[model samples]
Target chain A: MIINARYIAFWGCTIPALQPYVEKAARLVFGELGITLAEPEGMTCCPDPDITHMASHEYWLITAARNLALAERRGLDLMTPCNGCFFTFTEAISELKRNGKKANAVLSENFNMTFKGKVRVYHALEVLYDVVGPENIKAKFTRSLNGLRVTIHPGCKLLKYEEKRLDVKLYELTKLTGSTILTYGLERLCCGVPLMYLDADKAIELRTKPKLDRMKEVNPDAIVVICPACHNQLEKGQLMISEDEEYDIPVISLLELLALCMGFSPDDIGMYLHRIPADDALEKLGLI
Target chain B: MNEIHPLRKRFRSLPSSFKGLLRSELRIGHIYELTDLTVSDREDLGLPSKPPTAYSDPNALEALKRIAKATNLKKDTGFDVDKLDFEW
Candidate 1:
C-alpha cells in the first residue's frame, strides 16, 4: 500500500463525453485498490493534443500550464487514463519547465495562476505499477482471470515516451489478472484515430484494418487497452470495415479488467455500455 | 491540388477538428458535448451526471475562454470567436 495514493483525476474530453463506462470502471477500480481520484472543480481539458497543438503551439502550452497550475495549487499530482492527455501534459510540462518564466507570466496575468513546476504527471498505469507495487495488487486480488486470453493495444502516445515504461506496465498489470497476452505483428501500429478526420474509410482500411487483420490471426478473447481513443477507434473501426469481414473482438479497458478481478461484477463497472458487447468474453470468464 | 483538395481552400481544417474546436470554444470547455443519453447513462451507473471538471464548472470554461483570448488563438486560426463562426 502506497502512502497518499491520491491524484487529481484529469478526465480528458473523450472519456466523459464519448465513453463514460471507462470513467466508471476507473473509479470503481481505483476505489477498490484504495486510491483516491479527487475531481477538483474548474479543471479544463488537457486541451486535446490533436487539435489544440495543431492550432497554436503557444496556446496549447499556456492552456496546459493553467490546468497543471490548478493541481499545483492543491499540491497534488495529476493522472489521466487517456493517452492523448498524458502526452499533452508530459510535452507541456517539459516545455514549461524550460520557459517557466514566460509561461508563468501569461498564466499569472490572464488566469491569476502560476506554473511553479511543483507537480508530477502520470498515466494511470504508472500509479498502478510504480506507485502501488505489484505485491499490494497481488494481495488484493480476489479472483484469477486464468482462462481469459487477450491481446494488448498500447496506444501510440504510450509508445512515444518510452521511459514511462507504460507498455511493460500494461502487460504486467494484465498478467496480474492472470490473462494470457497474445501477440500480433501490428501491435505497434496506430489505431487510425488521427487519420479519421482526413478520410474515415481510408483511415480504417489503411491503419486499423491491417492491425485488426493481424490480431484476427491469433483469435484472442478481447482486445485490452489503456487509452479511450484507441479503444473507441478499434471497436468502432471494426463495424466500419466491410460487412463481409468478421472483426468482433471486444475491446476492454485495463481498469475494467482489474476491477473484475477485485470481485466487482461486470455490470458494476458498466461493461454493458461496451460498443462491442463483452458478452462473449464475460461468458468465458463465467461472468455472464 | 489546392483547387481540388476538399480541406485546403475552404475551412482549412478538418471538419471533425474544426467542429470539435468550435464546440470547445462556444459551449463545453471539452471537445464533445455531454449529450442527454450520456448524462442518463452516467447517472444510471451511480456516477454524477456531469464530472466535476469543465463540464460541471463554469469557471473552467471562463478560464479557457480567457486563455484563448490571451494567447491570440482566434487570430492565429482565423476563427471568429465572438460570432462562433469558422469560414467553411
Candidate 2:
C-alpha cells in the first residue's frame, strides 16, 4: 500500500473561527484516507488574497510568503480547504518564483526568511480527487448517500485557476458518494464573498440571489461547496437576501457530505454549525 | 534520460483518475520529467522535477493584470529589491 503523502493543513481564517465543523469533518475524512494532516504553528491569515493582491502586491506576497515559509520549515506542502486561502498560497508562490532571486532577496532582507520555492499548495478538493483517487476514496465509503441530490457552487478563485481539473474532480468524487449532482445554470457563479469587500448589496444581488434562484429548481437536498468562503457566503448570503419561504436551501461543505457517506452521523460533524442546518439533507440521507 | 509522459507534457493525462497517479509529485511551478522507476514503482517514488522550469497560473496572471491596470503599475511588475531598500 502506498503510504499517504503528508501535508500541512492550512485552515486559513474562516474555517476555524466560523466553520469549525469543516475542520472537524476534514480531519475525519483525512484519517480514513490514511492521509497525515499536520497543523503548523505560527500560521496566520491567507490574508485575504483578493484584497491584498489588489491593495498592496508587496504586502500580499510577504504575508503569503511567511505562511509558505512555515511549511518549508517542516519540509512539507500546504493543503487548504478554502479556495481563497489556496489561491493566496499557490498564487503567491507562483508570483514569487517568476523573480526567484528578487523575491528571495526581499524575504531575506525584510523578514529574515527565505522562500526556496519548494513547498507546494493544494485545495482540499485537489487532495481528495488527485492525491487520493476517486475509486480509492469511494472504496472507503462504508455507507452510501443513496438518494441524495446536490448542487455545487465551486468558488471563483479555483475556477480562475484550474476550472477544468477542479470541475472534473468535484463531480467524480460526488458521484463516488452515490449522489446525483443536480445541474444549475449559474452553478459557475461567484458566492459574492469577494464582492462583500467592495459592495455588500451589489455583491448579494449579483453573486448570491440569482444563483440561489436557479438552484431552487433542482430542489437539491443541499448546496455543497469546496470553499469555506463560499460556504459562508452562500448560507449567510441566503439569509441576507430574504427570510421568505421562497429562498431557504441549506448550504454545506463538501467534506461534511463526504463524511456522511463515509459512515459519519450528521450530528458528529456538527451540522448545526451551518447557518441553514442540514436537517433536510440528514433526514433524506436516512441518517436521522 | 527518461521521457515526460506525452499526456503529462500538458498535465492532461488521459483517464483523469489515473493522471494524478502517474506523476510522482504534483508541483505547480516546476516542469516534470520522466521517471526511471518501474511502472509499478513509479507512483511509489514521486517523479522529480530536474530542469526546474517555471510556469504561471493563468488566472493569477490575468487577475494581477487587472490589479496592475487599476493601480497604474506595470502589469509585469511585482515585489523587487527597490521595495526592500532600507537604511539604518
Candidate 3:
C-alpha cells in the first residue's frame, strides 16, 4: 500500500541521544511502506521542557507557535514520535484553537507572523497505523510473537490529549502481527520520566516501579513502548530498580520489536542503540 | 450519613497532608480530591502517587498548575477523587 504525505520528522532532542534505534527502525519500516519523512530547517524544541517547568504561559505559547509556524512555512504536517513533543505541540494547537485571537496576536507580535492554522500535528504511530493497516501488518510478520507476553506502555501524551485520535491500545497492531496483547491496570499509566529531571529516586519509586511491579506480576516477556520518554524511563528505571530485585524483562521500542518479528535483523533495525539490550529477547525468538 | 461533597470526599481520602496540598494546588478552577484517584488513577492522570525527585523543588506546584491549565481540566470533570484507593 502507498500513502503519500510530506512529514516533518521532528525528533525534539531526545531521539538522537536515547532513541536512535527507534528512528532507524521507523525509517526502515516507513521506507518499506512508501511514506516520506523529512526534517524541516529552523525547527525549535516543542516547548515541552519550558511549559512543564512552569514557564510563563505566554512564553510557552510563543515558542510552540514559532515551531508550528516553521512547519506551516514548509507546508508539511509536523509528525513527532516523542511523547513530550507530541503533548507540547498538540497542547499548543489546542490552546490556539481555543483562544484564536490571543494566540494569533502573540504570534504576530513576537514572531512577526500570523498563524493561519494550517498545520496538523500527528504522532508517528498514527502514520504507521494508517499506512501499514493492521491486516497488512499481520501479513508482513514472518514470526509470531505468540507465547510472548508483553505490556504496552501508552505514555501520558499518547493517552491524555485526544486519546481517541491516536491508536494507543495498539490491540489491532499487535493482533495483526500474531501476538497476544495483555493490558494491565497500569497500561495507561505514565512512566514518570518527566519527574526524572526533578526527582530520580521518587519518580522511580512511585511512578516507574509500580508499573514494573504490575508488569512483573503478569510476567510479561517484554514491555513495548510508544513514547521515547516512557521507553527510557521504564527501561532504565527498571535496570536501576533491578539492583534491589531481579528485574529481567527486556524493554523494546514497539517499532524495533515489530521489525524483528517481521524478519528484520538487529543491524537492519538499528537495535544496537538500546541500553537495556534486546539480545536475550532476540535469542528467545531465535532472531539472533 | 449524608451524601458527601465530591471535593470533601476527595480530601478525606488522601494518604497525607502533602497530597492534600498537592490536590489543592492543582484544584484551581476545578475541584479535586484524593478519593478521586487511586495510585493507578494518579498514574493514568499523569500525576504520580509518589512525588518525583523534583517534588522537593518549590517549582513543582507551578509545574502542576501549568499542566492542569494546558489540559483544560480546570472546569470539567473536577478531580475524580474516589479513584485513589490503589485497589486496582
Candidate 4:
C-alpha cells in the first residue's frame, strides 16, 4: 500500500493528557500503513465543543480558528483521533467560512495569523477506511481476530455529520479485523461523557448503564471505541458502578486492536494503562 | 451545546466541563495536564515526555495566552484567569 497521504496529526487534549495509550497505538498503526502523521507545532485543544462553546461560542470559534490556522500554514489537512475534535474542527470550518471575516481580523490583529480556510479536517477513522482502504489494512495484518466478538460504540459527535456518517465507517473498519461485531441496539447512543458535567449519577443510570447492560447480554469479549471521551466514559463508568454489578467489559480502541494484529506487543501500546484491564481480550489475541 | 440553550442559566454554578475549559486556559493551555506518572508512561511507550502541543512549546503557550486575553475569554467566562485557582 503506497498511500502517500500525509496530514498534521491533531492530538487533541484528551489523547495526550488522559489517553496516551490510544496515542501509542495510533503512532504504531498509522506508521505501518505508510501514512505520515506530522505533529502540528502550536496546537491546543479543539477548544472543546461541549465546554468552551458553552462558556462562550465566540471564544470557541476563535480558539478553533487558531488551531486551524496552524495547519493551513503548513499546507496540510488536520486529522484527529477524537470524535469531538473532528466535529469541532469540521463545524468550525463551516462557521468560519460564513463569518470568518471578523475572525480573520481578530486573528490578524492579535497574532498576525489568518485561517484562509485552506485546510480540511479528517477523523482517523475516515482516513483508515476511506483513504487507506480496508483491503490494504487487511493485507498488513499478520493475524486476524477471527473469533473475537466485540460490540461497537460509535460516539455521538461523529454521527451528527450527515455527509460522512462515520458510524458506517467505524463498523466497516472493525469488520476488517475479522472480528464478529455483536449487534447492539444502542450503538448510536451517546456514551454520556458530556452529561457528566451536569449530573454524573443520571449520566450513568440513564446513559452508560443501559448501553453496558445491552452489551452485557451479548457477552462480547470487549467494547470497542474510537473516541477518547467514549473510552473514558465506558471504561471508567464501569468502575464507578463496580460496587453494584460486575460490568467487566474492557474498552479497546480501534487503533489498539489494529496495532495488535500488526504484530506490536500489547505492552508496546500501553494496554496496561486501561482503567479496566484488557487481559481477557489480550489473552484471546494470544498477546498475553 | 450553547446553541441548544444558554449554559449560564442551565447550571447554577460551573460544571466540570466549565472547569475543564478554565483548566485549558489557565493551567497547561490544554484540557488536561501531564503528571509525572503520565510523562514516565510516555517515555516507556517511546514517545516524548511532553507532546509538541501548546503545553510543551513555550511559543505556542504564549500564543494561546495572548489569544485568550485578546478575546476576553476570562471576562466572558466570568472568572479571573489568574485567581480562583482550583488546580483544575
- Candidate 1 CA-lDDT value: 0.85
User: For each candidate, what TM-score against the reference?
Assistant: 0.93, 0.74, 0.71, 0.94
DockQ preference between candidates 2 and 3, better one? 3
Off by over 4 Å in 1: B1-16
User: All candidates' lDDT scores?
Assistant: 0.85, 0.67, 0.62, 0.85
Per-residue error for B56 in candidate 3, Å, reads 35
Q: Over the stretch A1-288, how does candidate 4's per-residue lDDT look in tens digits?
A: 599989898988788878889999999999999999998787877888787778778778988999999899889998999998998999899999998987788889987889998899999988998999888998899988888899999999988976796888888888888889999899888898888888889999999999999999999999999999899899888999899989899999999889988988889999999888989987886779
Candidate 3 docking quality: incorrect, acceptable, medium or high? incorrect
Model 4: lDDT of residue A142: 93
Runs of candidate 4 exceeding 4 Å displacement: B1-13, B82-88
RMSD of each: 3.2, 15.8, 12.2, 3.2
iRMSD values, candidates in order = 1.9, 18.3, 15.0, 1.6
Off by over 4 Å in 2: B1-88
Q: How well is candidate 4 docked (DockQ)?
A: 0.59
Fraction of the reference Cα-Cα interface contacts (below 8 Å) that each candidate reproduces = 0.82, 0.00, 0.00, 0.70
True contacts kept of 4: 0.70
- Residue A265, model 4: lDDT of 87
Global lDDT of model 3: 0.62
Among all windows of ten consecutive residues in candidate 3 chain B, which has the lowest summed lDDT?
B28-37
| A2-79 per-residue lDDT for model 1 (tens digits) | 546889998898898878888988998788778998885678778878867777787788888998999999989998
Give the candidate order by descending lDDT: 4, 1, 2, 3
Question: Candidate 3 chain A, which ten residues in sequence have the lowest lDDT sum?
Answer: A47-56
